[model samples]
Target: LVAIPPSLLPCWTIHTSQWSLENTIRRRPLLQLGDNSHRHLNPSTISVTTEREEEPDFADHNTRRSEPIRVDLPKPATRASTEAGGDDFMSSDQPRVVESRPSALTSNPVHEAEDEKDHGTVERPLVGDQVRDVIRLIQCRKCSRPLQEPVTLPCGRSLCKHCLPETHTRENISYPATPNRLQGFDCPYQECGRNHAVGDCGVDVILTKAVDNFKAEMEKARETITTAEVSTHVVIQRPSAGQTGTDMDDETTSRVVKGGPLVAVYTLADSGELDYNSNVTFAEVSSLGDEATAIDNRTFSKVKESVRTEMDCQVCYALFYDPLTTVCGHTFCRSCLHRVLDHSTYCPICRRGLSVSPLLYRESCPSNEHLKTIIQTFWADAVLTRGDALAAEALNRHREFDIPIFVCTLSFPMMPTFLHVFEPRYRLMIRRALEGDRTFGMVLPQRPRTANDTHFVEYGTLLRIVNAEYFADGRSLIETTGISRFRITRHGILDGYLVGKIERVDDISIAEEEDLEANETQQALERYESAATHQSEDSSTSRPAMTTPEDLSKMPTSELLSLGVSFVERMRQQSVPWLAQRMLTIYGECPNDPALFPWWFASILPAKEYEKYKLLETRSVRERLKICCGWILEWESSSWSLSDCRIF
Candidate 1:
């Protein structure tokens, strides 16, 4: 028995497992070396014997020996001959192993050739007889299929052109195309872990041809086996009860016995023909890695659409952004689901009731690993398409209509708000903002007992980011200034951040100083006349006699303006409250002009939000001032305890 070396076990075992019994018989042949007992055997005269093993039990039996069939093997192909194909064919210095069954026998006696000087040298097998399967272990690790258009890397491993890391496209399709040498990708194989530029690799045409030839042989063998199996099966008629025949059968059945690992069984069709394709066996799923698990010819052909669909958000119909799976075994993008739950406490796909509180926490809804692996492996094109689409969508998003929001403290116009963005959602938000408009809204979150009640006040300020400093960990310190006030028309979440459609709110500006002065004069006269009428109605005797409109018309216009101004001054001179004074100190001083003073005071004062809400409701500057002046007077006279104060 010729013992197979342990070093050859991996290759031989893989070959045995891959091919059927018939293929094994057609491929392997028995060979024997000249025995020392033969006295005519000279050291210089090397003798080789070859035999064709046709029986399946050839390896098991060693008692029989055939007559010595002395034959000469052809020389190995020269490097110059292979290079004729192309420069891609680099001649290998390593000794090539080949197998062949000699067709012609040499009858010359060994003693006659003993005197020859070059008699001992045995010729290498011919190139045509070389078995490419010997190098099958070096096939591409990714596809586990033989390498095509092989590119030998700097790491000394050759892989299919498509399997190289440099061949992978950018995640963002909109990104400018760059050379493969600049991509800098690490090798996928763990055994030879190294990083190299794509340009550094060269095509190995010899290796590519070898792999292609091996695949061709495998395909031809499979076709032969399929044809033989189909032809061997013929329908046999059942014998009658009166007839006693060796081939007699009560029920009809068709079976074919073949001397191989797999039996060629066939089913008879109604037309008395064998169904060649029916009941075919398939190879077991190999445990190669993520690529093999998620992608195969069967699965790929089954799902003809891109694999990215499995990782897409049902609502957005895009690749998942922070994916989350529901308890109903349905998966969705986290932000899309959150926005869906905002309207109802049920899952988007299944209508099953889900608690809103837990979904609010990212930890409670982790990404699906299987889907993620599928995307990262077999969906490069899909990922790039989705990323470009998302980037374009973000760029087109309007600041007034659909701006992302930071739901925290309130920010006023012209005020600076510093933020430490650490949350992954917020980081994504900041990154997107920087890429687009670099602007977002800041609104105060409604203080609810539970996190499930995620709400934001209607009024918020738009902040334009100035500069942001990002840390290595993806955290950022952003500096921004409130650009303008906006009231939320509608609210929703994207990815993980809040987004809203807002209308701009600004202090009403006058076109001219003359028009403002005229309006102020008209307002003072009207207020004075109305106040006089109100006093007279309250107490006729105590109050001064009311003047008729005709009489007031007779009075000088200058006198009416003077009286209104005096009344406003008296109210303004009254002792300011502690809360109002603290606000003035912190927010700097209020505006000197009476027309602009009310707006400045309202923004800084520590007043009830409802009161501030009322201030925001009015368009006239005079009306807002009147409300604030009245409140100040009431606080001074009522002697109410300070404990009643509540910061808004």
Candidate 2:
């Protein structure tokens, strides 16, 4: 895995950029103070704020007082503007009288009604609903009003200080006061909502300053920001039905009233130099940044709306849910990303091959944490509702009983199943299984004798993946071990493979310790003694049995185990072909425990696959051993020889 620096963490970075404090901020004109002469800005470290009015109470919400708020915005100047530049927006630091008109914004709001009733506050002429619709970046996300005591959250969004304690009032989440229980809540921002808790976040000093400046600038703009937004992008309001034709004498006509359309006037052109009627005024211009650096109030609101569109996940056609960014620099919801990977090991957005991504083999997150936080901070309520729906859907899936099945080979319990997945259907199955619980079922193909059988063998093993290596061609090599055997109850087809519901097959040795039935006991003893007579006549083992077949019959399991272990030791010493070095390396040394020896012997026993299949069918350990011991006695008596057991 690549080791990214802390400052560049949560994303990849380009190390070559000169990131220094010297020339970080390239300023632009904050506001135009004159309509006669245009002055281009020269971005600088030091700024000179010319206060045109002395001791002006910018926050006097009691009346419609006129105040001139001045800010110095310096930037690189164009040749025409620099040569013809007279004084700044004013002659000196003195207020200049200009024809002013009251800006239109709705005074009626949900919070305002509550504040007036509870706090006995007077209602001033605030921004109207049409203006509020276009200006939202500087307001409180929770209450949809100007921020009071703005607090910066961990998510990098600004919130009012009063919003944190209202978690209990807003949602049904209970914040228990138990000392041991962790205190936190799910994030509310819809785009990247997750769990979060209140931390030691005081009022953000920078955001407070920005908000204070905004309030002062907002009041000042009521008297000044009426002429133009930009050269072509202008803000225009339609005339009322009773108004006369273009005898435009009234300046208050520009004001948008309640229920008026918030039209964004566009005059886009393809010419190198813009052509315009000299009648309409235009905003001061500057060079835009990478995308844009300077913007008017209208531009800011439009950018916020555009960003909302980019936050949606293409796979689901909705907002991101646990978003993860790929190494290819594209982002998708984490669940959608893995679902795409199941079909093809490539990015859905760019189709970049992800076979070499370090994220696949190990469990490290490449999630868009900062993006989630910002989204959570914006639409917390909507995100909470979405999270609840997603959780319920996930719960329903877990309650279902379907499992993918690979019908290629016979797999026994507690044994390895090595696989080279080349088929497209099985590759997709393996990828999905690895991404999920790392489990799937393995069953043997139907034999010709059971030609009527449309599906695979009923009995199979559930394998858990241990390791895997993927190739560029989409094939993968994987190593897995059998977890348990299962019996298929119902089956269906998925894609090109099989999926089934199964029940686990556990060993049934609960009755093994009890005495066998009278007739069955007699039959077992006869079988052992008859085999014992041959052991005496033509035995390969040099050692004598410590107990006879008579002692073994009373406790049938232990006696059979003794018989099997001695025969295995004799054959192992004899260097039988099936017990060769390769076989030992693959399956490991023979197990000594009676409960385990049956599976080991059945694996390497040079018998037909159908005979070996019986081991999986029987649940009792004693029955499985009888099948193994019978094979050994038969192989010993006859001059039997064969090649190694077939794995494929």
Candidate 3:
């Protein structure tokens, strides 16, 4: 071994050491660091000679042109020749053939693997047919199952992946095996409780290959036995002692004629043209005659039991309906898995991430072909059972009304509302709504004394969700427009959400007499206001008279209309200030019709709830108009009084 200089020491590492200090010093020349005389010892001084190939100018159809990816590959190690220098650990001179390869000095097992893979010289166990026996013998000797994706340790024994116990690394030695620190995982085989770095413990690839080959061989052997049984037939004959030549010829001809049809029938059965009972054929009942009847019955019973267990869904604990296997290798009923993924993008049992792309468009996940075939082949009855169960469930859901309610802020007809659905109950409620009618009622909650006593208002606005965007965590942003107002007749909880049996609530129909009276009141008020304005010296151009309670009986319909119309015009002109502009922005220009104008003004005003509630109670348009006019007059008088005080 040659000593490296301090300047070059950082560039080179001591990869391997096999000799004692005394022996190594005697066998190799000693070089001191930072010595100008030993500048040759510097790694920078050594020139590497590599054969470079010129890149092709033209692009190759099969290859992509890109910069060469840099890899930290370990250089192959070389042992000194016997003639040049003796082995430091050897007493006698002997030459041994050494395969030049990278030194196994990497602390990271993953890097060690990459080096071997790039060099293409993987170490494999030297066992032929014995590989099968080796794997079986090394089985999680505790449970006695064949080694599965075996992890071999220094003990030379293998353990199934799951049988290995939790491991800990040097960093945070108290914490058990975690995904991030798995590189330094320790071997947990009972017999070999050794802390083996993950990459150091090579997987049993050779054993895996051996096991696969053994299974293939067994399958081939079974196929061959079945083919032989179907093709081969035995025959026996005994000649009658007192048979005439003509009688024997006729008997032989008749037997030969019947054999043709029998051969054709068997051929048709083999080709699947005949609908023969496969179970009977499998048990060789026909070939073995009546003696095989008992054996066939027992075989059929065992087969039915195995099929029932294998074809059942783990999630529902029932027969699989459209079986699907997730990326995590767990099989589930397709409908069951779809419902799970609607709320989550992970496998229910394993919590492993599952691809949600298919489910997003409501497409079925990839089916597990093996499970599907098994159900079709040995247990078609399970398919029928699953269908029956699904139908019954659907019927039950149908029997119950599926109105989903959203307990949120108040909404009104023709208004747009945006909502963020994060709560689990609301998320589910939205999904059910989208699945069925794409409509849900949005209601405000009423004040309750206790949490459990939460109740919503009787009347709510039904909203039709136009579009919804769902996030990965089951949160959704939905855009909805108010459909119509509905009054809850009966309310109850369903699936963690509020539901109500509701009837649509329409605006009260206005009577013709009420419209005529509203006109009459407007005319009378307009005349009385004109007469009072002529008599008052303080009258302004648009300002009207402040009639007393005594003048109420004499007021005419026209003057009242004048007051209401002037107030509305002032609001639209932005001259009269109001607290809220939300309704002004949303509803645009106030309605001009006498019948609707009063109700529209009442709804948009930022007035007391009791005042607005009173507006809804009045069925007559004239009455509502009267109430609104009084409110406007009161506000006008209050503003004037405040100005008069400020002037004084």
Candidate with maximal TM-score:
2
Clashes of 2: 14
Give model 2's TM-score versus the native structure.
0.35
Model 2 misplaced regions, further than 4 Å: 1-401, 448-452, 509-555, 641-648
lDDT (Cα, tens digit) per residue for candidate 3, span 193-244: 5454443344444334433443343334334334332221212121234442
User: Candidate 1 — which pairs collide?
Assistant: none
Model 2, 279: alpha-carbon shift in Å? 99
Per-model TM-score, in order, reads 0.28, 0.35, 0.30
Error of 3 at 418 (Å): 3.9
Candidate 3, TM-score vs. the true structure? 0.30
Per-residue alpha-carbon lDDT of candidate 2 for residues 1-648, written as tens digits (9 for 90 to 100) = 111112222211122133232143232222221221211112131132211212212121222322211112222222211100111112343232221221121111211211132211112211223223323344566654556676654334555677654342212121121221224444455643533334313465434444455455344333232432322222232233444222254222122211112111111111101111111122213222111212233333333233344556667655565555553445666656645653355766667654222222212333444345434433232233334334444333322335788887777777766777888988888877765667789887775465455446778888877656567898766666777777876565566667765665655312111213222454455565565566754453654343332343333565567668778778888887777766665567877666688888876666776678888988666667777776665565454443432321
Q: What is the C-alpha lDDT of each candidate?
A: 0.41, 0.46, 0.43
For candidate 3, give the lDDT: 0.43
Candidate that beats the other on TM-score, 1 or 3, i.e. the better one? 3
Model 1 agreement with the true structure over 145-201: per-residue lDDT tens digits: 445676655444556678777444222111111364344467676865644444445
